[model samples]
Target: MKPSHAIQGKTSEIKLLIESYGFVSPAIFGSTASGTDLDGSDLDILAIIPAGMRGKISLFDIQHLEAELEALTGVVVDFNVENSMPDHLRPPIEREKVML
Candidate 1:
């Protein structure tokens, strides 16, 4: 199955997972977003936290979410936080991201 379809099939679970981790605006980028994902391709995820919740979250929380998501999808996951990412990396990801 395509990566997007795999993700879509687990959308509700993913949504709940992200919300539980205080992440909002979940998106998929890179190969999965562009429909070119092959088996073993890592899933690239971008998520933003609401300003109000930012101070409450920790790195461990984010890493836990990443691991949980990878377990859920049975694929490697590369999770990126929009707020913490370098400015230079934003535009290209934004250009290709598919919102979840």
Candidate 2:
């Protein structure tokens, strides 16, 4: 099912931002993809970040990106580095993944 128009637009903006950062195979999951979002629902993103870029991303860098996405999308964002995610976390995200 398609997400609401507002969320869809925000997701698009987020995808563009992630793309600009050169992260590949960005996917969104959780409430954003499930269409069960409430007023406080946050956006969940999984990205296949390059190994070279991996070392460059820190808590601070991730925080900065999160802030940028929130500003651009008006939604709280939870960003996940696909390679770093635990095996258990992979299943649910994969099941509902919306690859951008």
Candidate 3:
């Protein structure tokens, strides 16, 4: 399959996978969401975990999850912790992120 935007068909599958791994509110952003993705661009994923479940989802765990997503989507996946992102990134992320 070719690279795609943050449409429901693509996002829904990723959303299910993310939730299964205990991540909450999964979303996609950057060029994919902005409708300018190139063949080489990676998928930008922004997500957070429930406060109560944070301990179970460590950085390593998220990295593994990101690998899974990359494999499934056939695109490099860049997973980001929503709360940890820089303040300056919030606006662009808000403007670009598509809810999954």
Candidate 4:
């Protein structure tokens, strides 16, 4: 799919995944976040899973999330999962992920 379509589709899927995972934090950051630039970019989503969910998370689960999102939207979505983040650290990471 085209990058812009991928960005929009991935952003929507990320939001739904966050909700399904029961994240209460009002600010989940993805490609649509302020200061995030999507020109020639891949999807970068920063999600704060619930506090008690800290170390219990799995990379496989994240991979599955990405796969599910891709299947639903026909867009490849990537994510970075963190737990109990302080309000300040959220934006920068989502905006400036290294594409390597």
| TM-score, per-candidate, Cα-based | 0.90, 0.83, 0.88, 0.54
The sequence of per-residue lDDT tens digits that candidate 1 reaches over residues 1-98 is 45666686797788789888888999889999998998778888888989899789898888899899988988888888899989999889989998
What TM-score does model 1 achieve against the real structure? 0.90
Whole-model lDDT, candidate 1? Answer: 0.86
Candidate 4 positional error at 37, Å: 6.7
Report the alpha-carbon TM-score of model 4 versus the true structure: 0.54
Q: What is the C-alpha RMSD of each candidate to the true structure, in Å?
A: 1.5, 2.9, 2.1, 5.9
Candidate 3 segments exceeding 4 Å error: 5-8
- Arranged by TM-score with the best first, the candidates are 1, 3, 2, 4
The global C-alpha lDDT for each of the candidates, from Candidate 1 onward, is 0.86, 0.76, 0.81, 0.55
2 against 3, candidate with superior lDDT: 3
Q: Can you write out model 3's per-residue Cα lDDT over 15-61, one digit (the tens) per residue?
A: 89899988789988888888888877888889887887867888888
Model 3 alpha-carbon miss at residue 22, Å: 1.3
Q: Is candidate 3 or candidate 4 better by TM-score?
A: 3
Identify the candidate with maximal TM-score: 1
Of 1 and 2, the candidate ranking higher by lDDT: 1
Instruction: State the lDDT of candidate 4 residue by residue for 1-100, as single tens digits.
Output: 4444554535555566655764433233445344453554445455667767766667777777767766665645566655644669756754644322
Candidate 2: segments with Cα more than 4 A from true spot: 1-5, 10-12
Pairs with backbone N, CA or C atoms under 3 Å apart (clashes), candidate 1 = none
